[model samples]
Each structure stands twice: as C-alpha cells, then as structure tokens.
Target: MKAQMFDMTRMWGMVTGLVLAIAYFASLYLGFKASEMLPMLVTAIGGFEMFLFSQDVWIKRKRKHG
Candidate 1:
C-alpha cells in the first residue's frame, strides 16, 4: 500500500502491533510451549507494524502542519 494512504487516526497498524506484542509476551510467559517460532514471529511482525505506524503518524503530522 502507498504510505500516504495510511490513517493515523484509525491506528490499525499500532493496534495490530500491540496485539502481536502481547501474543509474543504471552508465548514467552507460557514457557515457550516447546516451540521457539511463535514468539519470534510475533515480535518480528509487531516490530514491523509499529515501525510502519510510526512512519505513517509522522507523515500525517508533517503533511498537516508543515
């Protein structure tokens, strides 16, 4: 998707990041449950989401008042 199309007010990317972060933590808290993949995936995805969300937010702010 085009970066400009993102909506900071909607915050979908941030929310998804939070959820994925929680899932990663939960997996770690549950003793990893014999697999090391889930938590890693969650963290990776969440980090990317958060990165994208922050970029989108900054873009919106700049466009609004720059």
Candidate 2:
C-alpha cells in the first residue's frame, strides 16, 4: 500500500503537547512562584512533544525522498 500523508501516530504527540501547555499555564494561574521551575518544566515537556510531532513529518519526508 502507498504511504499515507497524515498518520495517526502524531496525534499522541499533539495531545501530549496540548496537555503540557495547559498544565504550564495552570501552574502559573495557581500562584506558583515565577521564580520556581515548575512552569518551565511543563513548558519543556510541551516543547518536546512539539518536536516529536514534527520529527514524524521529517521521517516521512525522508522515506518518501530516499
């Protein structure tokens, strides 16, 4: 079968990113000190999820071209 352009595997990464983003904002809203690392930790997790989702696209491109 031909490769599909949009795969479901990336959805998990997207969902994870969304959850982390929410948590990041919630942490700040809940009065966690800005000087604390809690918010940043959530931000990092969200960023990593974005990277994972984007990496899936890169891998598909590589497979298609090579």
lDDT of 2 by residue, 1-66 (tens): 233424444455567657766766786899765545655766776677668768989999999999
Q: What is the lDDT of residue 26 in candidate 1?
A: 80
True lDDT of residue 43, candidate 1: 73
- In the range 1-66, model 1's lDDT, one tens digit per residue, is 554555652466667657766776787788765356656766776677778679879999999997
Question: lDDT at 7 for candidate 1?
Answer: 65
Clashing pairs in 2: none
- Every candidate's lDDT: 0.69, 0.67
Question: For all candidates, what are the clash counts?
Answer: 0, 0
- Model 2 weakest lDDT span, ten residues long: 1-10
On TM-score, the candidate that comes out on top is: 1
Clashing pairs in 1: none
User: What is the lDDT for 45 in model 1?
Assistant: 65
